[model samples]
Target: MEAENKKLDQFTKEVIQDAGLATPSVDFLANVMAEVSKEKVPVKVYKPLINKVGWLIIGTLFLIFSFVLTRFSLGFSILGDWDLSSLMLEKHEINVDIPITYAYCFFFLLIFVIIQITMISKRFSRSLEN
Candidate 1:
């Protein structure tokens, strides 16, 4: 059984070699030089201005949503009404200024506007420079 298995392995290797499917010879130095040459040249991909503007707007909207969700989680707490003096506490009180959601949304909207303005100004400056 062992001899038969060895013969089968030898036959398989010979068949693969005869099919011109043998492993390639190493060209280590040549491959390195080719890769180095490729690195020296920069590859450019062009995107239309409209597409980029669309993506920027979408990202700004997502940022605004996340800010609102975070504020909503932090500002609201609920508990059942119970006798205040039951636990022998002298006084109990809760103070909330404003709905956190509105404040957070407004703040982030302001920031998003500022960033957009800055980016636009910079882009215009670069265009003028060229």
Candidate 2:
């Protein structure tokens, strides 16, 4: 049996050698590389929701608000005796009594939100690949 198997293997090898190996075109490597290079991989551009101009506007508004709040607090009205009482909330009337259970619930909610965001991002990325 062993002699027969050896003879068969030798015959198969001889036949394969006589069949000759396939030869690629002269510029096969170059052509493949060129094709690979030509392939367009979609790229996601990074664009902030708030641009520099938007940030500048927001910062200017914040500064203006701070200035107004400061002047109003010190009895120095920038609006010339304009009642700024509406802008300032009365501290005495405000009473908040939140339960510890609410804090735990909010904490759990935050964890769930973070997990969901990660899962959603991964799913979107995988979908884009296909």
Candidate 3:
């Protein structure tokens, strides 16, 4: 066993001497850094189809529509029986008895959640594509 170990050590020394050591070029780091800087990193720019003003207008219109629908469904006269001027004024007692506002809020939240889920799904799909 001692003789075999000596022979293995001698063989290892000879193999290491034959392999020789290597040195990198002086410009190797600079070249690698230059290549890395030149590489194009994808910039994800989220450009929505509908702008902020358009979305605001759409949301305002939808809310108005919902209000009108709720009033009509609840057997209330549209702008006829409920005097907006008198309601705003201190003369008439404001009737805040509609339970449908909760429903409307819930519906709006559901819609927003669905839209967010769709947008997230599209973003993930686009990332996978890249």
Best by TM-score: 2
Worst 10 residues of 1 by lDDT: 82-91
Q: Which lDDT value does model 1 have at 120?
A: 95
lDDT per residue as tens, model 3, 15-130: 99999998889999999999999999887666779999999999999999766654444545655676343333346566676589898999999999999999998988798667
CA lDDT, every model vs. true structure: 0.71, 0.84, 0.80
Predicted candidate 2 versus true structure: per-residue lDDT over 1-130, tens digit per residue: 9999999999999999999999999999999999999999887654679999999999999999876774456566668876655555563377798899999999999999999999998888777666
Model 2, 38: alpha-carbon shift in Å? 2.4
Q: Which wins on lDDT, candidate 2 or candidate 3?
A: 2
Cα lDDT of candidate 3 equals: 0.80
On lDDT, the leading prediction is 2
The sequence of per-residue lDDT tens digits that candidate 1 reaches over residues 27-83 is 978987888887854434444576977999989999887665433343333444433
Error of 3 at 105 (Å): 25
Clashing pairs in 2: none
